[model samples]
Structure formats: C-alpha cells, structure tokens
Target chain A: MNKEWPLWEVFIRSRQGLDHKHAGSLHAADAAMAIENARDVYTRRMEGVSIWVVESKHIHASNPDDAGALYDPANDKAYRHPTFYDLPDELKHM
Target chain B: MKNQSLIDYTLHLADNALIIGHRNSEWCGHGPILEQDIAISNIALDLIGQARNLYQYAAELKGDHATEDSLAYLRDGWDFKNLLITELPNGDWAQTILRQFFFSTYQYFLYQQLQHSKDERLAAIAAKALKEVTYHLRWSSEWVIRLGDGTDESKQRMEKAVEELYAFTGEMFLPTDYEKELATNGISVGPESLKEKWTDKVRSVFEEATLASPFKENNSAWMQSGGKEGKHTEHLGFVLAEMQFLQRAYPGAEW
Candidate 1:
C-alpha cells in the first residue's frame, strides 16, 4: 500500500547472445525486489534469459528540446550508410 | 479401480494444488501492487498446471470415461483430501505469504524425494514440478523476511499470521493411511520424514527475519488434522460452492 516505493527501469535480454532492451518500469522497495518484480512483469511469457534493473533516478536522459541539435546533423549524412561502399565480387556473403 | 491407492494418492496431491491455487487466484486483481498481483497469479497458474497433471494421471487410473475436468469439478467437498492449511482463508498478505513459504518448503523436500519414485510417471511429474516449487520457496521466503523485519506494524502483523497459521503446519507432516502405505512401497514419500528438514529451513529463515520460532517454545503443541481424510474447515465449503457452480448447473457444458 505504500505508494512511495521508488521506481525502477527494467531491461531484459530475450535470449543468449542478445543485448538487454528496455522492457518497462515498476516500483519496488529495493534492488532485489525490483529484479523479482521485473521477472514477474517482463519475463512471464518465457521472454528473457536475463534481466537488468536500475533505479529510474540513475538513468540520465537527453532533453527532448535538444533533439534537433543532437540528431538532425546525422539525418543528411547519407555517406555514413554502409551501402555507399562497393563490395568485391568475392565477398558474396556481405 | 486397478490401483485405488495410487489414484487416491494422486488425487490428494492434485487437490492440494487446486485448492491452494484457487485461494491464491483470489488475490489476482486485489494485490497491493500490480507487479505483485501478477506474481501471485503466476504462482496460482503454476499450481493449477501441476494439479492438471496429477488429475490426469488419477483419471487414467480410474478408467471409466474419467477426465481431469470431471475429477476437479465433479467431486464433492468430502471427496477432497487437500490439507486444511490450504483451505484456510487468506487473512492478510502476511498470512498468505507465510502459508506459501511453509507449504513450498514442505513440497520442496517432498518433491526432491518423489523425483526418485518407483513409479515413472510420478517421478517425471515430480522432476518438472520441482523446478517451479524451487522458485515458489525462494519468493515466499524472501517475502517472509521482508515483512517480518520491516516496520513495527508489519512485524506485528507477521507475528499474528504465524500465531494464526502455525498449528496447521503439523498436519503437513502427519501422513494419512494411503500416504503411509505408498511410502512403504516407495511410490511416494512419507510426510514424517520431511519434518526435520522443513523445521530447519523455517527456523533459519525466521532467525534471519528477526522473528521468534514458535516451535522452539513448544514442540509438542496440539496440532490440527483430518483434512487428508476429507474433513476440512468451513472455508472449503464456500470455495467448492463457487468453484463447482458452473459445472454442477450445466453438466457437460464447454466453451
């Protein structure tokens, strides 16, 4: 009934050799409880092989107001695309 | 009718799971928090799944168009052999968690032995269910410690829960006639053998939780029993009334 429990962000790795992706958030009294809560909430469907949890306060985010300055510069940089480089005929798999 | 004792044994196990699972399901949407709500419901689902497996085995033994649904929905209250502790009301969150911890601990050790049963199907079922029971034990144990060691009000409530539920713990270790017979044949474990290990685990957890062990105060205290023999608390009557209503009103009905 205590609504003041801190919020935590949950991340789950769906399988081996995969990176953890943001699943969602929940409130818990501590780290151990957060992990358990995340397990119940995010991995109930056999969705993950691993889980990671961090307090919401520990995660820093870039301000949405800076979206243009932070990401717009890369939008027109089509040269950064790997498709621009030609591959040798011998590199068939690439 | 070929192996009446075995069928009875299987139904006893199934009844325990189904009744407790039904009790836990009552908390589905009413949990104090959403995450915990899902957690208890998931545990309920696991128990019901175990019940289904057990009931299927029992039905096959009885062999006259018997099925798991019939076994679960058709039986009267007196026909059930679940432990009385499972049928008791979930008085509070603390009571429910404590009941789970005690029962899961008993099941944890019981299944460990059952995994080696002379019956192959029983052994296989025990092996699979052991994995789920392991998580239940851990989850319930952690909650017991948290609530027992938390603020004064929480600690007080945990103490009250222990007082309300501890006597029923004794019935878990008291084997019924069928259980005793099955134990002799190595088909199932005798509950008597599990008492020491269950007590040790509960005591250690209680120590860590800063709670006193009631068993230490009086090891020979009077305990409740008879559920395994089909006698149950009044609470089970209400539970069965609601659970069996649909099936009773409309026989052979299906979605």
Candidate 2:
C-alpha cells in the first residue's frame, strides 16, 4: 500500500575535488533518507569522503535532439583540453 | 583450565556474531529498498567477518585439527553459545530492525569495553569489531526512530516489535560461569553491569521515537536464557540446519 518513493541521483566525492561525480541513482522517501541511502549504496567501500543526493526530477537535462547544437561546438574546441598543451621537458611529470 | 574458559568465552562471542549475521543475511533480496538491502547485507558481512576472526582464534586454542569452518558449520544448536536474542527469527522489517537495534547497542558497549581486555588477541578482535558495531548501532537506531515515529501503521508495528524482542534483551546480560571468570580476570565486561547503560541508551532512543519502553510495564517479564550455556531456542535449530547443510552434505568441499 506504499507508494514508490522519489528517485535520487547520487554523487560521490572520492577525495578532494571541486565537484562530486555521479555514482548512481536510488529511491528514497525523503532527502534525509536519500543521503543515508546514498552513503550505504555508493560509498560502502571507502569510495567517497562526501556525498550529494539530488532528486532526479530536479535535474534538467538538455534534449537529445539539441545535442548537436549544445555540445558539438565544444568538441571542435580541442585547445580547451589540457592535453593540447605541450609541457616543458623539465615538467615531464606534468 | 584457563585456556578452556578463554575458548568458551571466545565461542560465545563468535556464536552471537555468526547467528545474527546469518539472520541478517536472510534479508538479502527482500529489503524494503535496494539500498537498504545492500546496507543490511554489508552489516551481515561485518558480523560474519568478526565471527571468522574469533572462530580462527578458537580453532588455534583447540589444536586437534579444528578449523573455523568446523567450529561454525559443524556445531549443533546445543553447542552454539549465541544469546537467545540473536537466534530469534527475523519476523518482519520492524522486528528485524528492532532486534538489530537491541543487539547492536549491546555489542557496541561490550566491544568498547573488550577493546581493553588483558587478553591481547581478544582485545585486538574487539578493537576491529567495535568499528563495525558502531555503524550497525547507528543504522539500526535510525531505522528504529524513523519507524517508531513515521506513520500510524509503522508506529504500531514498531511497538509490537519492541514488546516482543525486549524479553530476549535481558539474556544478553545474564552472566555465564565462563563470563564471570573472564570478568574477574579483566578479560570480559561484567554483563549485568552493562544493564544500566543499555537501558539508558534504549530509553533515550525510544523517547525520541515517541514509543514507550517495555521496561515500564514488565520489570519481571520471564526471560529466555541458556544460550550462553550452549542451549538455544527451537529457531536456532532451523537456522543451523540451513546454514550447515552444504558443509554437512559435502564434507571437506572447498572452492
């Protein structure tokens, strides 16, 4: 007789990072339960130092039909990638 | 004599872990949600891991080719010294969570004290097990709070769960002869001494959850015992029958 809870996208920060990467998704009754479920599901193996759970409904994704206009321009901007830079011989580790 | 008592005490701890770990595992693929399914299974694995360590140590004490598998898989109900609470059937989600909350709370305190035992290996095992039991306590207590306060149906179910399981809680503190000897040697915590703290912890959580304590009504509820002395309830027989099946059917089978 219980209704299905909301879907939450789980983001886990494995270490020091500016952003948490999407680990997976799960269903939880509320935001508090979402965080706890995210911890148990996505971070059981010392996988993350922090977790952020956002309801999937709250996320806005670009239409797949607009992918060409929204993303193709970035693909041609090869210089945006750090790999395009030539490191000095002394900075080999970089 | 000293070694025998140590082995007995060690098996007591191992049996509690093994039986409860097995009980928790019955929830696999049957949890209310997938995340909780994984969470409970992880807790089960932690308990079973603790049991493995204790069983290994016990095997070392008993030197006639006894192994962890033999101790865990070959033991009959009367040989298992797990407390009666651990062997009870996982009735419902409410019952499961409440049972876990009661036992894990006790284990958290017991392992905290055991971490300082004079026996070096037991202390080491307790130190490792304490970390896992801490999480188990938190997880189960949170569930207890949520269910007890969530909805009319949940509150009713949780109250029934608490009432049914509370009687078994007392047996966890009943001092066995081996435990008494170990207590004198600073190797085991005096079980009865822990009752006050256990009651306080349970009372505080129940209060927050808006559920009444069972202690208020039945201070003299008949308690089930004898598990520490290697006697157990009928439920344990079924648990062992299923758990010991593969090993019993195919002796010496291994991966």
Candidate 3:
C-alpha cells in the first residue's frame, strides 16, 4: 500500500481586513498542493477570498500536559485592560 | 421548420442535457477526489439549468403539448438526442476531462451561434449559456493540458483518453434534420459552421496541453452516430432508470 501524505491546517480570509481563521484541515503532498486542496476542501461555494496553508507539524503549541502552569499567571492581570481609557469621538466604535 | 417541428427540436436538445446532467450527478460524492467530484457536479448543475430553460421554451413553442416535467421525467432514454460523448461512461478522471473538454468546446461554439438565432427566446437562452459555457470550456481545457503534460502516468492516461474519447465527440456537431430545417427557415443556426470553430478551439487547447492534435496522432474517423437522432448507448438506459426511478415510482411527486 502507498503511504499517505501529511495533513495540513487550512486558514482562510473570508474578505479583506478579516483574520485568516482556521477553516479546516486536509491531507496534501506539499504546501503548494495543500493550498489548492484547501481551496477545494473549504471554498467550493466561493466562501473565501484568500487561503493560507501550513503543515500541521510546523505549528508550535503550549504543552497540553502543562496547561495549568502556562495559564495560571495571566489570569490575574486584569489591570492590563485598555477598557478604562475612553476613546476619542472619532474612534467611538473602537 | 414549422413551430411544432421546432418545439420537437428544442425538446430533443433539452432531453439530451437533462439525461446527461442526471448521469453526471451520480458522480457527486463518489469522485476519486473531492475537487473533481464538485467540478463534475457543478457542470451537471449547469447543464440541468440550461435544459430547464430549453425545455420550457420547447413547451412554449409546442403551445402546451408537454410541460417541462413531462418532457424531462416522462421521456424514455431513446427520446434523448444528446451526442454519444455525454453518454459514454465516466471511465476515469482523464476520460471525464476528455468528454468535458470536447463537449464544452462544442457547447461554447454552439451557444455562440445560438446567440445569433432569429428567435428572441433562443437567443436569450444562448446568450446566458454562452457565458457559463466559456468558463466550463476554460476549466476543462486547462485540466486537459495539465493532466496530458503533467507526468508519465497522467500523460499515458490522457493520450489513451483522447484516442478512446474522440469517436464519441463527432456526434456533437452533427446537424440533425431539424437543425437543418430550422436554419434554412431562419429560426435557428445550422450546426455545421460550429464544427470548424470546435476544431480550432480543441486544436489550440490540445497543442497547449502538449498532446497530439487528434489529426496529428491518427486521422481515424472513429464516429458512431445516431445519438442526435435519439439513439443512445447501453449506459444511457441504466442512467435513465436511476434518474426516472423517483419520478417514475411516484408520479408527480415533489419536495
């Protein structure tokens, strides 16, 4: 039997100014093929305007085994919020 | 042709699209790959949409002899006048592309000629179809080029495909008696003129794809006609069974 190619994570920007949200994942032979595969996999209905595909292996993440240690400290930093500062009239929506 | 004859002609063309579109729909979720699956289904939808319009026009032309549903659902496979190319089994991805590339090329030219039809209804439908067909033609042409030149495996399959598929392609532009009669009376365009345009378009795409221009590889007049005359392949009968099963089993049933 033939070996399967590695899987990649797919991210898509639905429109300009929007973040490249993680849409889904699919298997591909390489990065270039990944983007094309993502196009077919995720955007058949013309949902996204842009696509970015990266090998799932290339992504680094905090250790799920050490999750509490990585998260306990930042929980107390409420003072870091910018909510106290009022926006100017031109920036009212922000 | 007289108005009644013209309506028969339109129903003939419409039935071809309807049956083939129904046949293609079988591949929707079962394609070897997801992208290709969607692409084939998309083409099916396009053909079905086009058939809906043509069948409606046929009904109007007949002054209410048969509704679109009657023309589509009630008709036997023998009544469909589509070319043999569309009815050929989807042998493989390469074969599918070959059939699509050939059909879309003919469709593009045929619709272009149809856009100039004397009848306003036909002209309008052709104008709309011309735009969709342009995209279909381009997409199929691009895939043909890519697969034909991509690798040894793909190249061999594609070469085999072109040779195997060419026979069925000829029926597409063959002028039926109805097409001839309508053209003489100024209601529709003769399909003969579009043959050259189809040849030129197919030649360029084949050249770009690095495959032998059919004439370059082997000048074989591998044609099996009678499709445009409402005869069809064995595969068409099975396809009709599936397409008509729901409608046939429960007459006039709708969602």
Candidate 4:
C-alpha cells in the first residue's frame, strides 16, 4: 500500500536506430528500476540496444490551446521540402 | 561425475532453473505493478530458457531416445533434482524477492565457477547463462535491499521471509555423492566451498539493507533436504501437475 511510484517515460534505441525513441511509460521507484522495467517491457523482442528513462514531470509539452499560434504558420511552408534541389541522374537513389 | 553422475548434475541444474522459473511465472499478471509483472515474467522466461538448454544437453548425454520434452514433462515430482529451497511456495512479494535473492546469488556464483567446467557443454551453457543470472542477481538484490529498508511493514515482511527461507539454503551447499565426484574431477565446483563466498555476498547485502543474518551454526541438521535425492515437498507435486498437464494429455502433440 505504498504511494504510487513516480511515472517515467521510456525511450529505446532499437538495434537499428541511432537514437532512442519514446516507447512508453511505466511507474518505478527510481531511475535504475525504470530502466530495468523498460528493458523488460519494451525490449522483450530484442528490439533495443540501449534505453533511457526520464521522469514524466521533467518533460514540458506545448499547450493544446496554443497549437494554432505555435505551429499553424509552418503548415504552408512548401519550400521546406528538399525536392527542388537538382541532382545528377546517378544520384537518384538519394 | 562421469556418465550418470554428470547427467545427474546436469539434471540438478536444469531442475533448479525449471522449478524456480515456474514459480516466478506464477507472478505473471499478478505483480503489484504492471511493469514488474512483465519484469518477473521476463526473468521467468530467461530461467525457463536456461532450463531448456540444460535439459536439451542432458537429453543428448542420455542419448537413448531421450528428448528435452520427455525429461521435463515425463519426470515425476520425486524424480526432480532441484534444491528444496527452490520448490518452496512463494508466500508474498517479500518472500518471492528474498527467495530469488538467495537462489540467484547462489546461481551467480555457481555459474561463474561453472564457466570453467571441464565439460565443454557445461562450460558453454554456463558462460551463456552467467549473463542472465547476473541480471537476476542484481534485480533481486536491489528489491531485497529496498523492501528490507522501506517501511515497518515491509521490513517485517522481509525479516519473516529471510527467517523462513534461510534454513532451506543450507541444502544448497550439501553436495550429493555425484557432486562430490564432479568437484574432484574438475567437472563442477564444490558446492560446499561456495558457502563462504555466498555468506560474504549475503552478509554484505544484509548489512546495507539493515537486516540481520539468519544464519545459525547448528542449523544444517534442522534444515530441509531430500530434494536433491528425489524427495520433495507437497508443493512440487502440484507444480508438476499443472506444468506437465499439456504433455500428459496430448501425448506428443506438437505446436
């Protein structure tokens, strides 16, 4: 009947990934336990080479109410695409 | 420990993993937390995988149409050679953790020594299993310390777990005749000699956890035995009945 442990966000670097990706969340007593729990739950399929866990409280998220003000302007920026760049015929794979 | 003795020793190792792994699997979906439920299940799978490897090797050694499934599912409860400590019921979270601490600590040391076994298969299997057992040891040890130091109720539960499980531990060091032979032949390490190292490891962890050592000098005579000799508690019967039911009923059905 102990108080609920703190929530942690788990990130796993899959064997093919160069960076850890946010996988899921779990409750743990500490960082060490969080990492172990992450390994057991998220990497049971040989999915990851590394793991990182951060307290859920530590992550800041943008407010839903400000979503239009924060990101709507970027939606019309078609120049962000790299398709306009010219490339040699031999470089087509890129 | 050549031939039958070596086979017996291998079976002993297999049975330990199988029984304890079975016990841990009992925690599936029942853990206090969802993550730990998965955690214990993962450990259970590791142990059962180890058991499969050892049992498969044992089957090869037997070589008279013996198969891994047969060795695992066909054996009667009394035919199992796991330490009595492993067959005990999982009483509570504290008891489960403490039992795991005791067994995995011994396995950690045993596997480390076994990596150098004269038998190449045992050596290879031990080398592979040493990795998993190392994590098992760490996980269980951390929980033991956490629970022992956590709160009044937690500490009391851990203390009771230690007292209940400590007596069963002596049997791990009591070598059977075949084990003595294997130790002499360099096929396996002497279980009796591992006592001091096990004691040191257990004592250091206990000190950190602020728990008292439950060891008593004259406890061996009073400690339980006969599992290694094919005698077992009532618990093993129930465990086997459930574990072996599929094989028993299907009679060689394959998935």
Candidate 5:
C-alpha cells in the first residue's frame, strides 16, 4: 500500500500543431490511466487535440556533463548555419 | 406562465447538476491521489457549468427579473426537484465513484434523447451538455471497475457503496408531474424511456468489475423517493446552506 505508482511524461499536440510537445508528468497505475491523468492535468482548458504519454523510465536523456563535448563543437562551425547560404529574394519563406 | 411545466423541468435538471457538483467539490483537495483530485474537481466544474446553462434557461422562461444566480442561490431545499441520488452524502471514494457512475450513465442516455426534444433551446442545451456527460460516464465507469476489482479492502468498500446507493437509483426514473407534462409535449425526455439502456450499461460494467447487480437480486426493492417533489433528506439542506452562504450574505456581490 505504501508503494508509489509509476511516473509518466505527458505530451500534448495543440489545435494547430503537428507535433506533440512535452506538457508535464504525473503518477498513474498504467498507460491508460496515465493518458487520462495527462488529460485532466494538461488539457482541461482546450489546450490540445491529441495526447501521448510515455513512462518516465522508458525515456532516455543525454547527461548534462556531456553538454560541452556534444554541442560546443558545432557552435564554432559557421558553415553549419543555414544562414550562410544565399537565398533569392523571390523565395520569401526560405 | 404558459411555460410553467418547462420552467420547472429545467429547474429540476439544474438542481440535479448543482447538488451533485457541490458534493463532488467536497473532495477537491481530499482525493487519495493528486491526479484524481484534479479529475474530480474538473467533473465538479463540468456539472456546475451544466447547471448554469439550465438555470439560465429556466430564468428566461420564468421572467420577472429572475436570473441564474437567483434561481440557484436563492432557492430553498424544498423547491429543488433533483432526484434523491444526487443529494446523498459522499460516504467514501467508493461511494462517490459509484454514485457518479450511476448518475452519469443515466445522464448519458437521457441527454442523448433530450438532444432531439421539440423545444429548440432545450435540444441545443442537451446537445452541448451531452459531450461533457459522455466523459463523466467514462471516467466514473473506469473508477468503478478499478475499485470493484482491486484489493480486498477496495472490493469490500465498493460492495458496501453499491448496497447503500442502489435504493436511491430508482428515483431517477420516477418522473415528477412537471416531467410527465413536458414529456408529452416533446419538451423533455421521459425518464422511464432511459431506464433500460441505463440498466444495460450498468450491468455490463458491473460484470466487468466483478460486482453483483443489486437489481438482479431484488427487482422490487423499495426505493427512497420524493426529492423531485421537494421532499429531500437533511443532507441537501446542509448542502444548500453552505453553497448559498456567499450570495445570501452579500446579495448582488461580484468580484
């Protein structure tokens, strides 16, 4: 009876969105309950058209200690920037 | 007024929502789990929202400067026409879940038929409220199954709740005079017509939950009634006193 339920990470796709963004996390006994908890927690105010829930333990995250090695090398590479390419004025969105 | 029956019928529907919403709100911060706390609170809000719509419609029909707030906050317990089941105390988590499941199942079928009412305004309100009621039925049904089929303590508590609550379920289908009058004019859905569908849904859910249907054992069990005619248990008086305190203390007050 003292045991804690598993945690789930909630993702919500807003009315105009194609991707589900991380909303928050909650505790539930199972995946079905997790989705419902997410609905009550995150989407009560018409915030989303869709919901996705993943068990917290199933999600893998990069270590914060690897930040410099993983990301700093690309920072000094100016050519990696798409801004380096010239675009025609006629191609407005690009 | 020419629409007295419709007005009373609308008020009955409003009272049912408000009283149940008030009961559910009592669990706002006291739920066993935080997630469930929010879930019950959301359901309470939805019921209150439905109450507001029905009250507004009733007020319009009643005229004479009546408003939704006045209709809801100023009415006495004896004037309320909600079924007895809605005003019963929330004994425990199991009782609250079972009461919600029973009431929501009835509402699901009732509103589905009401959406086709000859009265355009009533039909429109029913159509809008049906979406919220559908979710209520699902949430409460899931909880009923979870608790009924859970550990021994949970199962025992659910059984006790079923026993305590079954006697009140009959009153939902016992139409009051206003209901009977409005049903004939197609302005209201007859409660009698929704009984079979409600029973089917409840029996199916009970089978999954591993709980025996009380109706199966005693089809002719004596049911406590009279709430629709304004004869309510003492519980509703207490509920109204607390709910109406603010409005009574400070008339016309607004934030």
Candidate 6:
C-alpha cells in the first residue's frame, strides 16, 4: 500500500529462443516483488519461459519532442542497409 | 468398466472435478492477494476443464444426446457422484489447500494407475490428466507449508483444517462394490494401492509445514461410500443450482 513504490513493466519470453516481449505492467514495493508479481499475472497460462520487470521510473525514454530528430533520418539511411553490398564471386560460388 | 456401465465411473470423475473446482473458483478475486488469486483461478480452470472431459466421456458412454452442458447443468444434485470432501466449501485458504492436496494426491496416483488401464480410452484420458494433476499437487503443497508455518493465526487455521478434513479421505480411498468388480475384471483400478502414495504425499508436506495430521483417535475414519454410490453432501445441491442456473435458464444457448 505504499505510494512511494513505483510501477514496473513486465516482459515475457514465451520460449527458449524467443526475445522478451512486453506483456503487462504491475506495481510493487520492490524489484523482487515486481518480478514475482509479473510471473503470477502474465505467466499463469504458460505464457513465458522468462520474465523481466523494469521499474517504470528507472526506464529512460526518447521524448516525443525529440522523436522526429532521432528517427526520421534512420528511416531513409540506405547505406546502413545490407542490400547495398555487392556479392563477391568466390562467396557466391561457395 | 464395461462399455455399458462406464457411465457410472465417468460420472464419479466428472462430479469430483465439478464440485471441487466450483469450491475453488469461489477464491477468484478473493484470495489473500493477487498472486494467490491467479494461482487459485488457474487450478480452478484446470479442474473445470478436467470435469468437462469426464462429463463428455460419460455422455458418450451413456449413449445420450446430452452434451456435457446438459449433464452438468440440467441434472439434479442426486445425480452427482462427487465425494463429500469436494462438496465441503472452501472454509479458508488452508481448507482449500488441504482439500486440493488430498484430492490431487489421490488423483495423481489414481491417474498414474489408470494410465495403464485395460480400457484404451480411459488410459489415454488418464495419461493426459496426469500432467495437470501433477501441477495441482505442486501448487497445493507449496501453500500448505506456507500457511502452516506462516503467522500464528494462519498456522492455527491450517492446523484446524488438517484435523477437520481427515474423515473425507476414507471415502476417497473407499473403492465401491462396482469398482471392485471392475478392478477384478481389469476394467477399473483399485483405490487401496493409491492410498499409500497419498499418505506419503500428505506426510511429507505436513512434516515440512510442521502441521499435525488429523488425529486418528476417536475419529470415525470408517464411513459409507456415498458419492461413488450417487450420494453427496448437502452442499452439492446449491452448487448445482448456481452452476446450472444460467445454462438451465438459457437452454440450447452457446456461450
């Protein structure tokens, strides 16, 4: 019931080879309890093999005001893509 | 276990799940906390799923057009075959744990025995059910210890539940005459062999939790096998009423 404790986001990895995906959020007095809560809430249906809980306040984010500056250029950066590379003849032969 | 008489056996299994699961489902949104609520609901849903399987099989065995819905909802309470233990309400979290622990222990051993049953369909169903009952055992055992050794109030309540819940085990192990005949003919399994493992399971949990088993002294352990014979506790009637209320009201409707 302590108001000072922060919310935490829950991520679940459904299978051994899967990446952790956001499942839900919960409030807890501490990180350990947060992880435990996440497990109870999100994984009851065998929904995950792994669980991660990040204290909501501890997670930093790009501001909405800065999204255009941070992401617009990356969208059109063709040089950063793998398609720009020419295939070597020896590699192709193998 | 005859193809014709299998209806009785199947009804007993369905009634056990429906009754016990209904009692457990009452814990939804009312467990000690959110985690416990989720755990209880998880087990409740499993029991209901299990009951559905049994009911469907029973209907098929009876050659009735009745689906699991009609069998569960439309039937009178006398038609139910669950033991009195399952009909006992969830008096507390401890009661719930003790009830589940007792039932799951019996179920695990029973299903394991049934896995090798001569009846291929029963064997297959038991094999699939063994996994679910195994998890139910784990969940119930964890809480039995936690509650038994928890705060003073919790410890007292859990200990009391252990004592009060004793007599019910007799009926669980009381293989009926029909069941005996089936076991003799290799159609059904006996509950006697299942009793040893159930005792061991209960003993280990009680040992860790430091709770005493129900006192055997002056206790009426020998009781009639009512449920297997189609008799039930008074609670079953109300449970049927509530469980069947909607289905009965809206007959032929699909959820």
- Return the top candidate by DockQ: 5
Model 6 steric clash pairs: none
For model 1, residues B1-255, the per-residue Cα lDDT tens digits are 298889889999999999999999999999989989999999999999999999999999999999999999999989999999999999899999999999999989999999999999999999999999999999999999999999898899999999999999999999888988899999989999999999999999999999998785657788999898899889999999988899999999999
Put down candidate 3 lDDT per residue, B84-167, tens digits, no spaces. Answer: 777778787888888888888887887788888888888898899887778778778878988887878989999999888888
- Candidate lDDT scores, in order, read 0.93, 0.91, 0.80, 0.91, 0.92, 0.81
Collision pairs in model 4: none
Candidate 1, position B233, lDDT: 89
Tens digits of lDDT, candidate 2, B87-114 = 9999999999999999999999899999
Clashing pairs in 2: none
| Alpha-carbon deviation at B138 in model 3, angstroms | 3.9
Q: Per-residue lDDT tens digits of candidate 5, residues B61-140? A: 99989999999999898999988899989999999999999999999999999999999988998899999999999999
Recovered fraction of real interface contacts per model: 0.85, 0.77, 0.23, 0.92, 0.85, 0.46
Which residue pairs collide in model 5, if any?
none
| Poorest 10 consecutive residues by lDDT, candidate 1 chain B | B213-222
> In the order shown, what is each candidate's alpha-carbon RMSD?
1.6, 2.5, 3.8, 2.5, 1.5, 4.5
Cα error, residue B80 of model 6, in Å, equals 1.0
Candidate order, DockQ descending: 5, 1, 4, 2, 6, 3
Q: Tens-digit lDDT track for model 4 on B135-237? A: 9999998999999888999999999998888888888998999899889899987998888889999999998899987766664336788899899989999
Give the lowest summed-lDDT range of ten residues in model 4 chain B. B213-222
Candidate that beats the other on DockQ, 2 or 4, i.e. the better one: 4
